[model samples]
Target chain A: MKTLFDKIWEKHVVESITNGPDVLYIDRQLIHEVTSPQAFAGLRKRGISVFRPQQVTATPDHNTPTLNQHLPIKEEASRKAVEALRENCAANNIMLFDLNTEYNGVVHIVGPELGLTQPGMTIVCGDSHTATHGAFGSIAFGIGTSEVEMALATQCLLQSKPKQMRITIDGNLGKGVTAKDVILYIIAQLTANGGTGYFVEYAGSAFRSMTMEERMTMCNMSIEMGARGGLIAPDETTFAYVKNRKFAPQGEEWSKKLLEWKLLFTDSNASFDKEYSFKAEDVKPFITYGTNPGMGIAIDGNIPVNEPNVKALEYMNFAAGEKLLGKPVDYVFIGSCTNGRIEDFRAAASIIKGRKKAENIFAYIVPGSKSVEKQAREEGLIEIFESAGFVFRQPGCSACLAMNEDKVPAGKYCVSTSNRNFEGRQGVGARTLLASPLTAAAAAVTGKITDPRELI
Target chain B: MQKLTILTSPCVPLNVESVDTDQIIPARFLKTTNREGFGKNLFRDWRYDSEDQPKSDFVLNSAKYSGQILVAGKNFGCGSSREHAAWAIADYGFRAVISPLFADIFKGNALNNGVLPIQVSENFVQTLFAEIEKNPKTEVTIDLPAQKITINSINLSEYFDINDYKKTCFINGYDDIDYLLSIKEKIEHYEVQKS
Candidate 1:
């Protein structure tokens, strides 16, 4: 009995050592500025080169300035990181997508949109959001910097395989529910550490019905819940999305790949170490009020009365049993590996269209990738955003980690579509309320946390 | 990597739950490549006031507490995958952190960076916190080879779990790269076979 995760993991196993971790071969590896420099340094210390430079792709995303991206990055530490990446990639013969390149964007977004992430491939990145690649039925996960060095030096990782978990969401999704809401609800129910020892497979009707971009959003936050990664079985919807992507296979190779991908689903008799079932009706447009993703509640619901909730509420200055429905929002940020796709933009832009951004709100509409930016412009999404007084900035992880100049001021509240709501995640003393793009859009227009369903 | 077979130190209790990596080392400090300087910015937001002055109420700044061990609330290191959190802790002179739960990536990062993340039971953690509250300078000993953490003042001892592979690395001060090099031939052989 082979589950989808089992099949993918087994096929990639290069050597299994007794009482030790499996030596798994990597099919593709993504490197970003923040994590790769130290790995390259370790390699130099050992007098070793990247084992398979062809399979490695380097990009500078985390440290790149969102605005004025064409000019030199101004922040001293941020500039050094980007420059080090440029120099290292050049010296190591690794392909790089630097700032201003059409291919330049967040590493997670650029990889799949360019077709580098494919089904049945074992993908790894130094960053945790690498799990986003699992939307295509691939076994993907994040690694530490030392593991990045290991992957570069050997094209293999000594990894202890994680146990399997199957999370099945059945029934139809209610109105205003998005892939983001479903995940937030799961994390809330499961808690941040719920999936710590498992690799989750999102299955059944709800996940099957999600668009590729939606699936990507769902998998992107898997790390937030402490899961090594999450994956979905690739079907026709996945194939269609991968068909003409820039790096996707062409001609006869496409047909051959499609046939193999179609067989990637879990067998009926396959057993998982643990299983969970949830109803799509139970999921609603959600928002996190506290410091962690797990401290989320429904749009109209009260915060849970618990010890963690008490601490989180104290930090957030929110009272338990007090409704979060009308809390004012100061900033609205829409971008990250979590919800920066074309679909996310469409959802936000549709809500913002024909209405101006609230005067009290500073809304930033950032696309995930340069490709996404181009598509948004061609589709006039950018025009709608700009006309509504929202700033449509160039693609980088702006205001997500606040690595650049676009930081929310201290003590301000931001309705962000990013993955994490950790304390001071947006900036020092800045509070983040993680929400779907639609929810953020709703807040942007109303200057408060209004349910997107009310606006829709 | 530092050999961590046995460590004895006082504990600084941070009772707040789910202390994430962002709280440990803020993202603004993650831009630099050098790992050593991170200690100064460890818990940058919490340790300092808006004016960049050290807050007297913060545990690290208090005269009553001084230790190489941090006894924290559950779910320590739960956010980003930045190893700088571990670097900050190690650089700040903490040899070990005892918690009821730890996020997986952060635990791995801590281990690789020579900061021991010792997972004890919730009751044990609460007891440690209470004991630390009673006496901030109470000493605790962690024996890595025996997988035991002993709170000397409380006369309590608990065993922790670590994989043999990691345990070997921890005791010998070997990093992942060191192990990879030791098994370089095996990696090369498998790569050739796969190709």
Candidate 2:
């Protein structure tokens, strides 16, 4: 009727009988080491087996060190969490992608690359960035431990459907701009909570121009603005990306599946609850000034100093008005499910090819997946990074949320590509400025905040 | 060990819109998995200044009202899937969070931690907000057994449909594991039959 999102949501809703919550069938349940322990424990304590083991997939990513897959985890708590996942998966008859396995990496990265994440599937995970799966035109969102248990026991979730919003970005992106910048710009235009009750569909000329990888990066960040998730209609770019993935349809079946996926878009007369549009040219590489993603501004813009409110000023540590340029930085972290892909690396490395690290800055470059790491290394991107004094770490969620030893010291200012600059997301007392990969790299090399376009 | 009983007082109105997870528990405190002491840091950044002093702007810092149940505006707990946010809310002494809407993940975490998340109509939410504005001491009652919430002398009867199994465990103060342990005899019988 409207789009696949509407169709799938309507079809899977078990019932709404009179006045009640709708029980929605979850088509896929992805788990990772960091959040699944308590969920698995809940299941065992209830004496319940996973209702649909085939629908659930587990991986060890967050706490797994990227440096060496063979080296045992150094942190005791991290090691314990990883081991617990292995043991839990074994006991529950669930599939696990432990470190050193071909399937190991960020759950978001692994799910799509393996073809395990497909179009029109409702995917749930214990991690918020689960919106990454929506790139394939699916309705995906994160669930908590109890919900994970509920999904495990029944393969269904009691959900109240979210409102729908379509954000259309038209025109062509200027040279040097990427999908990361587009989403950052959108967040800047709409405050962090702008899309609170809506599932956003990204459409128009700009979105259609994006490659599947680019679309994935854009959709991966839908949660930043409080959207339930983001999606792009399937096109040739989507078909091509899934064609050879590990789990996608094969041989003669692939062509037939492609034909069906082509129908995933909204009809010309489809309606959305709300609509907004922006020009691609207005988008620029952005960085956060306040504690949230919506508080970002273009790299070239001044930190707002003239706000009448004291809370805004105090939260951002900003004076009345100060240019962000040349502001000293203490750390630069470039990795997360959000921007850890090869394209992100290439965009960053291209800007830092001949650059030297700032005298006072500490920089770390962590890839999102082993596959991305291998690809970057094969292209000699590792050498370029090492030569620039950037630490090339293994594939895992590194300083994104500071789960392990990777943390910024208290009160230090950091420029990161990872989402959420909330107070101490990187570490207790560490002030974070969220930006795109290129912007983070530029800041790392300069030892100060600099616009990525200047480096280019 | 004694059973964990959360005796909630009449619901105290919060009346703020889009209360995100960051506002519940700032992202800085999410590093640890241990669900202890988060109540102090709950809304730490929003509730306090850099000098560890309380911010005058935050509602929690206000001297006008204080109680266990929180009545908030639309879209409460809108960011991050951090259980710490829920733990912080519960530990901070909030027994129920009433809003027009709640983020799916945040709602799940609240239920698991024994903090009830009540979804009400927008008109009711507005009425609650107005009442609280008129009198900060306004109170509402939430009777979990009856699955009903009463505010401003208006009774809003609603059913929170949890998993049938989870509902039993919660009412009995048993977690999933405790429920399973209690059924060990039956499970053992079934195992014997299979063997």
**Candidate fnat values, all:** 0.57, 0.23
How would the docking of model 2 be graded?
A: incorrect
Tens digit per residue, CA lDDT, model 2, A297-391: 78888776564434445755777677787889999998888988888899889988988888899977998887888889999999999998888
| DockQ comparisons of all candidates to the true complex | 0.65, 0.21
Q: What is the lDDT, from 0 to 100, of the residue A84 in candidate 2? A: 86
Name the regions of candidate 2 deviating beyond 4 angstroms: A66-69, A304-309, B1-66, B71-75, B98-104, B111-114, B118-138, B142-195
Model 1 residue A401 lDDT? 89
Highest TM-score: give the candidate number.
1
Each model's lDDT: 0.88, 0.77
Which residue pairs show collisions in model 2?
Answer: A45-B176, A45-B177, A46-B176, A305-A320, A305-A321, A411-A429
lDDT of 1: 0.88
- Model 1 ranges with Cα > 4 A deviation: A305-308
